[model samples]
Target: MNRLRILLADDHPVVLAGIRALVEAEPDMEVIATAADGTAAFDLADRLRPDVAVLDMSMPGPNGAEVAERIARYCAQCRVVMLTVHEDRAYVRRLLEVGVAGYVLKRSAPAELVRAIRAVAAGGLHLDPAVAALAICRDPPRPAAPEAAAEPTEREAEVLRLTAAGHGNKAIAQALGIAVKTVEAHKANGMGKLGFRSRVELVRYAASRGWLGSLQP
Candidate 1:
């Protein structure tokens, strides 16, 4: 099998070294390049288009979210993961909107970073257990709770839960082993059944149901 190429960016030298050490120690992973700030991160990732870009949330120039946006625009296939000290839901929402595939906390980096890299690289979402619970709370699209007359099936609930947690349609499809179109279908059906008119409403409902913490796969 081929090795997984990773590009990492963090401002701190020691932390960068530590992460690099952890990644390079893996037999199937390789660190192709490292950057000290978001600008360097963006430049390296955009050019190299590594399988995954592991970035610090607060770098000097662009920041992790900004770098993720640029990478997604230029190197669409390169997955992005954030190593952040901030567990704020706002940050998660911003980066998720930019197509970040993984969100891992700095506190859990030693134990979780490798798994996060692999998961995102393989087109799946990986949220640190603690971060997953507090990171991003999707604003419910509707004001009131869903009308009791209709409810979603198990698959539909699964789709909405992941969607509310900020996975895009394609990511959700990959995670659930379904087609992108199928994800769209499930999301639409679930939304209609629950009186959720938009992504915002679905998110709110999921949050209300505490579905974000369901980080299965």
Candidate 2:
């Protein structure tokens, strides 16, 4: 039986050990390698090519964000999960833009980290809900296509609402009793029709439309 192999990186020794223990305790996950800085993390990742790399975002040298960027480009097969104390919307959005598959705050429970590692290893986006709830972000403006940006179908709205509320695609799929692909397609179509570029933007849009029940300003 194949288990999920992980490369863990953090500058702090105690934090590194704690996270390593948490991951090792899980039956399905194993920590294959560990690194103390971003440069070492990048080097270890290149050598190990683990299923997932949980990187501390503020590590020294190249830094976790830079390491994530490199891993995404050079080790496309290995998923990058940014483990950080940063819950800033800008930082989270920037990490996602750089292709990190998961963004988890250090203050969050250890179980959340496990969930994020598993989710990204299986090719899914995983975000901490507290960070995700701060949905406003700035992006370069694109020309609005009003025709293409028409009102979404009922199903699309449903998907967008759940998505805005911080539900992963798989979770939304299960809730709606639809395939994950279907959930993704609806989300894409809805975002296209609404001129939304990111999940946070989609959440704000959904809130504006009253599709999401209580996510307010």
Candidate 3:
């Protein structure tokens, strides 16, 4: 079997070492590279195009959300999983709105990180369980009270959810077990149906409809 390629990004050397150790300990996984900041993370990821990028949420330059977006645009096959200490639902919500794959809290155990990586690599979403619960219960009113009903097909909804979670066309296709062209079709159809002309609007629509909750991240 091919080893899972991984890229680590964190400003702290100690944390970076810990993550490298955790990932390298897994026989099926390999640490391909490490970046000390978000900019370098983006550069290395664009160059190496690892299977997954374990990024710090509060990194310098673009931050996690922006980095995830860049990865989706430039390295569509590579998935991004945020590793951070933040439990802020809004922050998580915002990142998911941009289609990020996983969100693991820094407090989570190393095993949990491994679990998250595997889950996402398998085309499933994985949120830190605590974060999921908090997001679900903390502010029920936010997602529960959608102002409009932007009708979308089942496949379109799926595309929207995955897109909002930061999966690119190729990743979405893999996750949905469909062709990349089909993923693009669904994304286009969904956006057209929602009357959304931009990814930002699509994200807002998905967030209002609570589609982000249904994703793994």
Tens digits of lDDT, candidate 1, 162-214: 76654667667777899989998998888778776554455446655766443
Residue pairs with backbone overlap in model 1 = 140-204, 141-200, 141-201
Weakest ten-residue segment in model 2 by summed lDDT:
135-144
Candidate 2 local lDDT, 59-103, one digit each (tens): 989988899888866776678888888877789767765667678
Taking all chains together, the TM-score of candidate 2 against the true structure is: 0.68
Q: Is candidate 1 or candidate 3 better by lDDT?
A: 3
Error of 2 at 17 (Å): 0.4
TM-score of each prediction: 0.70, 0.68, 0.75
TM-score between candidate 1 and the true structure: 0.70
Clashes of 1: 3
- Candidates by TM-score, descending order: 3, 1, 2
User: What local lDDT score does residue 35 receive in model 2, on the 0 to 100 scale?
Assistant: 93
Look at candidate 1 and tell me the lDDT of residue 159: 85
| Steric clash pairs (candidate 3) | 99-164, 99-165, 99-166, 100-165, 100-166, 125-216, 126-216
